[model samples]
Target: MKTVAICSGKGGVGKTALACSIAAIIAGDQKRVLLFDGNLGLPNCDVYCGIEVGCTLGHIVRDGRELRDAVVPTKAGFDLISGGSGWKELAQLEGAEIDALVGDLMVLADTYDHVLIDCAPGVGNRVFPFLRASQGLMVVTTSEAASLMDGYALLKNAWDVNPSLTAGLVVNHVGSPAQGRGVASEVQGIVGQFLSQELEYWGSIRHDSLVARACAERRIFASAFPTAGPSQDLVDAANAIMGLGVEAEATEEISMLGRIKSVFGKKTEDSEDKAA
Candidate 1:
């Protein structure tokens, strides 16, 4: 299973949008996907995905619910686990508690092929723990200088906390094609040169009025519109994630009959027949 985090140093960069899009595409492809709305204090995932949550990550931790019970299903065929709603509770955990919390989250990995975490903006405690649990990190940024700088800062933080963490870049709000390429090049250069990390360009979401429109309607634009450029770009980004091409190989190939036989081979009667 691959644990991918969609995070940004600053908020309002369409991080949740990118995360939800990835979750939708992964689920659509028949892959079991779970998305955690790690942005606890300013939680909007439930609203964006049109899900009314009975339980959130904050509730599970503070209210004494099991982690399994915190996961809520959305209309897009994916699961969502949310974070704390109250700002005071967001940074209210100690180091040990954070460690224990992440340990519990690992159990879900066994049941999912992809777990996409939508981390909160800025370098907060909430962001790092999620980053630690993740196998790969994708930083969402815009064309603004401050956003680019924050993206680098987040990359630096990730490296400081975990040296082996692989990172990806998803440029959002590209007002123009030229500006998009420049943003990608600038961010990728900083990561490659200063951090000594290869930044995976997961593609960009062009500036679209539909995005804001959907947010106003409190729904994922991708699922609602389906044909919007931003929505299409998000699907391409999800494909890029799954197509990362991690190595997994079986020892040998089985024939069609052998494959069918293998399914039934687990039966006690089949075992007896083979012995006989």
Candidate 2:
């Protein structure tokens, strides 16, 4: 499966909602999609997708459950692996614990078409593994100054980890087309100037009452209001994400630990040539 890390350095940018929606859209296209909530500290993907928590990553680490055992099917047409809210240990997991989690996730590469990791806000032990292992990075941000700065920080952190990993931007809760493009432009300019990195404009989601209602009701917005403009925007964005092409590892036949390590310990020269 192609793993995509959906992240934002700052919270309240609607990252979880976008990830869940993208999963739902891709799953509808006869693709087996897995949405793994990587926000171990403040996981709310389950809440946004309107699914119940069963076992989570915590189960695998703390309870000795298999990775697949934590899979929960959502009505939105995709499978989900919740990060298990309220588990302080999960939020602070690092080193060997993080390795074990990534190793297990690598085992499911053949089971799904895509695995979208809804990453937690900020960087560090819990988030790095996912970003390193992913073939795609989707940075969710808003026109707000704080979200822009923090989102850029998250992208820069990812670049530091994997310089070849190009990221796409999705400006959420935009007030207007001008506002959305302006946000994308600001980030693009900053990245090009400071980081010398390219950022793709995946598109934007306008603020909508249905989205607010979905969050308030703990449901997926596209499923609740498929006809909404913002819902269509999400569909377009999901298509763009699916269109992203990544060079698959030729040697996935190695051991799970080896495979995960290959990604975690990869060098920039061994990865995509900083192209596209």
Candidate 3:
């Protein structure tokens, strides 16, 4: 399965909402999509979709429950592995524990066409494992200056962990497509010039009040307000993602456990270098 991680450096950028809408759009197209909420500390995919989650990854980690048992069905036609909110222990997971959890989640690879991970905001430990494990990474941001900076930071952090890693950008809460394109271009230019990295523009989500209303109602905006501007934007973005043509051979080369260990080793080497 092709896995994608939806993340941002700052919160309140509509990351989760966009993730849900994109998953809904993909599922609507008859593709088997699994929405795995990887936002451990403040999981809200279930809340955003208005579905009551019976269990979560928290249960699997804390209570020794089976991973499949935590799979919760959603009205969006995609199964959800809810990241139940307020699981503090998740923020403190070590490398081995992360490897175990990811290894279990990997078993679903053969079962779905896409597995979208709604990762936590920021470039913390909780977010890296998901980012490293995924085939594609989509960084969400707004038109604001602070948001762009943080989004760039997220991109830079990801590249620092895996320099070969490439990511796409989604400008949310924009007034128009031109505005979104402008913002994406600025960020892309900066990253390419300074960090020598490349970022793809995956399209943007317009600032539609209907999206907030749908979220307030705990529903997928693509379903609740399909005709809305933001909804259409999400659909377009999802289509772009599908067209990304992620290489199956490259995806197969990514072992979550190995990636985690490699990242740890890199960090350790960097630390020792600085100490010298």
Candidate 4:
């Protein structure tokens, strides 16, 4: 399976909605898609999908439930493994907890063509593991200055954790596609010039009232408004992600990329070595 982590630096960037939209779009193509809510303490992908849930990843970890049994199929054409709403243990997972989660995640992800991980909105320890484990990372940001800076911080820290990470940027809630592309280009060029890491402009979504309406109505935005501009933008993103051509690295080895250093987040001293 090709695991793709979707994250942002701060909250309220519509990352969750975009993740569900992308999942539905990919699943629409007849590919098996699994939308894993990696947000830990505050998981709510089900809310966006407008689906009822019972057992979740939290049950799998906390109560020893089977991974297969915990999976819930959504009306949006994909499966969802949600996270607990306010599990403090889940929020502060470490050591064995994280390892077992990653192990189970990979095992569950094995049954699907794609896994869209809706990670917690930050660069904390809990979020980096998913970033390191995934074959690709998608950072969501708005056009605001602070949002762009925080998004860049997340990218820099992500590369520091996993040097092999291939990243992409998605400009969300833009006034126009050109505006979003410009924002994506600016961030992409900055990362290339400083960190020397490639951040592809995956795609961008416009500020559509339908998106908000879908969220308020507890429905999948793209399915509820397929012809909307933002939905088409999400479709473009899904196609770009499908065409990314993820490398066939062993998942276990990929999970171990920053196992030792990421907890403390120690960086290599030589910047040149990093850029290499």
Candidate 5:
């Protein structure tokens, strides 16, 4: 099973957005998907999945309930286990408590083809164990300098803990093409030179109002507005993960050659008409 933890150093940088979207795409393709909302202090994956939950990871951790009891199904053909709202218990969990939670998490992880863990912003003690346990870490960041710096800090900490941990970077809420490429290049350079971490280049998502609208409505953007740019970008991001060719019918954005031909085709047509 492929376990991926989606984390960003700073809050509100589209970590959950990218995690849920990738999970949905994998599920849509008939892969067994399990998503754990590790952002225990601020749980929103449950809301995004539209599952009303009476129990969550909080119950399992604080009340000594079984992890199976906290599993909640969602409309997107996957199970969501919430991290719980109150983090009092999580903040003070002992080494034994962390070991127990990790043991339970492994059982759930074994049941799916892919497990996506949505981590809260930062590299706190609570977040460290989960990041280490994951198969690989996917760091989500924006073009903002603060976000990149924090992401770097997380990468550094992860490296210090284990130099062999596999990691990839994803730039979120990218405003323009230039900005996206710039951020990607900057991250790749740093990871390559100093940390020597493997940086998988997942493409960027343009900032769109639809993402906010869908979030406010407690729905996923992919299902709510599949035709939107963000949705298409999500699809591409998933395809990249699987190392599969992207669908030609999904969006107008295509290979560089295809784009050039279309532009020249339009120019040629205009010139022909003027000559005629």
Candidate 6:
């Protein structure tokens, strides 16, 4: 499966909403898609898709529940693994524990065409494991200066951990397409110049009231308002992401164990840098 982690450095930038819409769009095309709400501290995938989640990853980790049992099918035609909200224990998971979780997830990888992880915003511990495991990392940001700064920070952190990590940028809530492109260009230019990293502009989502209304109704805006501007924007973004050919790998180059080791190794280096 092509694993993609959707993350942002700052919250309230409509990261989860974009993830749900993209997953729904792909699933609507009859592709088997698995959407995991990896925002362990504050997951809202269930709320966005209007599904009631009984068991979560927390049950699997803490209570020894089966991973497959925690996989809940949503009305959007995709399977969802809901993350635990207010579960501080999950936030404290060590590198080995995170690898164990990814190991369990790999069992279901062959069953789906795509696995979209809606990661929690920021450069926190919970974010890197998914980034390391994923073949593609899409960072969502708005036109605001703070959002762009933080988004670049997130990209830098991901690259620092795994230099081989492929990443893209998605500018959301833009007033115009040109505006979005400008924002993406600025961020991409900075990353390329300073970090020697290139960020592909996957696409952008337009600012529309329909998106807000759909979210308020606890439904995916793409499905609820298919013809809306924001909906079409999401469709275009999904198409761009698919064009990246993240699934074209002949073999898995990085195993779960490798991911864990890489992440932990980077953590140690980062701590040392701080101490220096």
Index of the highest-lDDT prediction: 4
Candidate 3, residues 144-226, lDDT tens digits: the string is 88898999889988887766555889999999999999999999899999988889999988898888889888898989988
Task: Quote the lDDT for 196 in model 6.
Answer: 90
Name the candidate that leads on TM-score.
4
Q: Give the winner by lDDT: 5 or 6.
A: 6
Model 6: residues with Cα > 4 Å off, grouped in runs: 246-276
Among residues 3 or more apart in sequence or in different chains, the pairs in candidate 5 whose N, CA or C atoms overlap within 3 Å are none
Candidate 2 per-residue lDDT, tens place, 67-92, comes to 89989999988999988778877877
Model 3 is weakest, by summed lDDT over 10 consecutive residues, at: 243-252
Name the regions of candidate 4 deviating beyond 4 angstroms.
Answer: 246-276
In angstroms, how far off is 142's CA in candidate 4? 0.4
- For residue 206, give model 2's deviation from the true position in Å: 0.2
* Displacement of the residue 267 alpha carbon in candidate 3, Å: 52
TM-score of each: 0.85, 0.86, 0.86, 0.87, 0.83, 0.86
How many clashes does each candidate structure show, in the order listed?
Answer: 0, 1, 0, 0, 0, 0
Write candidate 5's Cα lDDT for 101-196 as tens digits: 867888878888777889879987767777777767778889888999999999888777656556777787878656777888889998889877
The segments of candidate 5 whose C-alpha lies over 4 angstroms from its true place after superposition are: 243-276
Evaluate all candidate structures by whole-model CA lDDT and list the values in order: 0.79, 0.84, 0.85, 0.86, 0.78, 0.86
Residue range 1-276, candidate 1, lDDT tens digits = 788878887988889877887788789899889987777668778878877777777777777778999888888888888774664554576667777777788887779888888887888676788888887888899888899899899989987887777787888998765677777888888778977888877778889988888888888787887888888778767876776535331223335567778677768677898899
- Residue 137 in model 3: shift from native, Å? 0.6
Show the lowest summed lDDT stretch of 10 residues, model 6: 245-254
Q: By TM-score, how accurate is candidate 4?
A: 0.87
lDDT of 2: 0.84
Q: What residue runs in model 3 are displaced by over 4 Å at the alpha carbon?
A: 246-276
